[model samples]
Target chain A: MELWYTEKQTEYFGITAKIKETLVAEKTEFQDLAIIDTVEFGRMLVLDGMVMTTVKDEFVYHEMVAHPALYTHPNPKKVLVVGGGDGGVIREIMKHPEVEKAVLVDIDGKVIEYSKKFLPEIACELDNPRVEVIVNDGYMHIHDHKNEYDVIMVDSTEPVGPAVELFTKGFYQGIYDALKDDGIFVAQTDNPWFKADLIRNVNRDVREIFPVVRVYWANIPTYPSGLWTFTIGSKKYDPLAVDESTIPEINTKYYSPRIHKAAFALPKFVEELCK
Target chain B: MELWYTEKQTEYFGITAKIKETLVAEKTEFQDLAIIDTVEFGRMLVLDGMVMTTVKDEFVYHEMVAHPALYTHPNPKKVLVVGGGDGGVIREIMKHPEVEKAVLVDIDGKVIEYSKKFLPEIACELDNPRVEVIVNDGYMHIHDHKNEYDVIMVDSTEPVGPAVELFTKGFYQGIYDALKDDGIFVAQTDNPWFKADLIRNVNRDVREIFPVVRVYWANIPTYPSGLWTFTIGSKKYDPLAVDESTIPEINTKYYSPRIHKAAFALPKFVEELCK
Candidate 1:
């Protein structure tokens, strides 16, 4: 018997990858999630019929989102990652020697548990002593924690669904308050091509709270807008004004200190939105 | 009657876009091409059933290919464009006041004529008195003419089909011989994510012929790899070292002199390819 799995891009479009066998599939509160061993993208991980990551190209998204902001801050010790239930962000944050503690807050406990069980390569670092996993709404956690963290990262889903509040100005203000004065925050904005208007609106909203706000681009093949954008907000240092000579001595597959500085250089359409 | 069009992405994977009308569908000597007026991507122009460019986001590809190499040179007098049959390169080249003469060599004559008729906004400058149109193979022309042009731009297609020779070492050496001692040449390399192997191979080939070679990236929506890379070659000057104070006084949709300088800064993966 042929086992079929579907990866939905939208309500209208999806690609079905033929699975030889189902490694794991569990019905979470959110939706049907699964991990299937595949030939092309290596071990394929999916949540709510949406693709989270494939082993072949997960480094592009995970490294790009984690390394730039983490390496930019003068001293990043206590870090908070919101909604990255897959633990990819936690894996990347461990590379920084200065990070003494990392707090991960996600609304869904099942996603985290499932990822730990099936996607061991990505979730391997979650069991480290420095990581603290909290099952709660990220918005409420940020509102309650005041001036507590040196860096905050939001790795939520798309803005249209459960991730809607993450894009609001109120949530950004909460994030601003959660960080120390010199703290930096980074979040996955969206695809710039199909969702330029959405990206523009979010930039306008985030720029209102942070003194230094910039957007960067990366390529993730599974994403709807193949050209993905990430927005960075800082209270002290500008993301573009990074010191090239002082990059951290860490082994990375996708990002370096030079790229951390170059990522903020936006194209004309994106630059117009920031202005 | 409703006209229905379906594009199959993978086996048994397809999305049907509502097409109001089909504009152009013909089998050229090179490839099968079609232009369909669609809903989401505007007038979608497809080459070999693959989406090439749309009216909505063609500026990202055009402005990126033209401005970076042009603005980096202190004074570019004569320019040569290879494989930009759409005339978008010529349109951007005419913006520089120092450019006295421009030559456009495209192997396909039908694409040029069709573009002039359909894409008037982009192809308007092709009729300029300073511009010369040559409908011959670009490889032969560059071989015959050595040290005649100050700037050479290769705006060809991907490496798979008719543009296979453009990515070879011999073509790069021919391009090196065709330029003046201080001249600079730029070509669109493959995508960074899916085409890293091709990019590395081409980078190795170009490194043999040019003293200073750099790989820069841009986010183009329609390309196979949304993370697009451009390979630059120069004889005397480094592409990264630019005079930022001297901003160009030109009205552009996508590129500025400030961006021209910034495009040379590469991510770690790209920089590692150079080494």
Candidate 2:
């Protein structure tokens, strides 16, 4: 007998993985979640039939989502992660000694509970002394807060279901108000292959609210398209102006000083989306 | 009812696309060749059940392979492409006005015959007056010529079956000898995800033979991994030293003057492969 899991990226295309056995499967309050062992990717996490992250390549996504925005800010002491229930982003964010406090907010507590049991390597940092885990809607959290965080990271899922509000212009405006004067924020802007219009719209929306806006990219194979993009909006600091001297030596597998600047150099087709 | 085509990248992982219909399926003397109508990727050419190229994303691969080498050299007049049966590389090569002639040598003539009929968008330039189409062994052709070409592009299949010899160090040495003193050559090095050793070995082998050797990247969705790497070996001109003003205004969906330099700036894990 054989078992396989597949996610249809589009109506006509999808990716599949042979599963060794199911670790956990649940109907969470917000979405369906599962963790299964795989032959190639070790253990894998899936939400709403979409592959969220894999043990083999989670470092790529976590490092990319956290490091670019963290390094871009000169003094990012207070940090907040919206809708990152797995705590992967917080783990990467806590690496910087400059970060005095880190807060994570997700609407679903089941994702956090299951991840701690199944994906310990990624979820261990959620219980750190400097970190705060809040089981509440990230949208309302951003709406209520004002000039609270120095660096804000949106490690949310795609624009679907409850997360649709995160991709809108008003959410970006709320995030703009939630950051300090010199604050910087980054959001996973999705792929430009099938979601070209989504990327273009998000980039344009952020550009209107922030003085400095940049679109960078990272490659995470489990995503809808392996070519993943991220958009950074800053009040004063430019991500491209991040000096080499200020880049601290952190333990990472994918993000580096040279790659920090290189990620912004989009291909011609992807460059067209930013325009 | 629905029909789908799947390629197992490894024992546990694969990518699939819905098949509209099979255009052509045959067992040629060299390998299995098939053309299928895909719902999302348009027409796709598959060899041995592995996708070689697709009409939708072929521009990314063909443009990435030809433009970097073409733009690096101050003057690229004589060019040779070995094992590019589909003539996609030749089409891109002929775009350069400096090029006086281009030669395409592939072992399988059936591929050219089928490509001309089924993939006209990619293979139309094979009949151009400036192109010399030869049905012969690429390895032998390289060995027969010594310092005869200004630029050589090895658009060959992966290191499997008859294409195994193309990835050997001896074949790279043959390419070095076949080029003029200031010659430049580029070859598809595959993806670092499943072929890290191949990329590392190719980089090491080419670095020993050429003074200016660099590894670059492109994003092609249907390939084994979305992230693909290409290596260039030059005698006099370095790909990194390409100036902005010298880059011609070419019609490409992926390549650009900024991308020409950015492609060489790989991710940290990919950069570790080159080391």
Best by lDDT: 2
Candidate 2 residue pairs in clash (backbone atoms < 3 Å): none
Per-residue error at A62 for model 1, in Å? 1.8
Ten contiguous residues minimizing lDDT sum, candidate 2 chain B: B241-250
Quick one: best TM-score, which candidate?
Answer: 2
Task: List the lowest-lDDT window of 10 residues for candidate 1 chain A.
Answer: A7-16
**Model 2 DockQ (Cα-based):** 0.77
By summed lDDT, which 10 consecutive residues of candidate 2 chain A come out lowest?
A242-251
lDDT of 1 by residue, A178-231 (tens): 999899999998876667788888889988899898888766766664667899
Q: lDDT per model, in order?
A: 0.79, 0.90
DockQ of each: 0.39, 0.77
Instruction: Estimate TM-scores for all models.
Output: 0.91, 0.98
Q: Candidate 2 on B96-172: residue-level lDDT in tens?
A: 98999999999999889989999999999999999999999899999999999999999988888678899989999
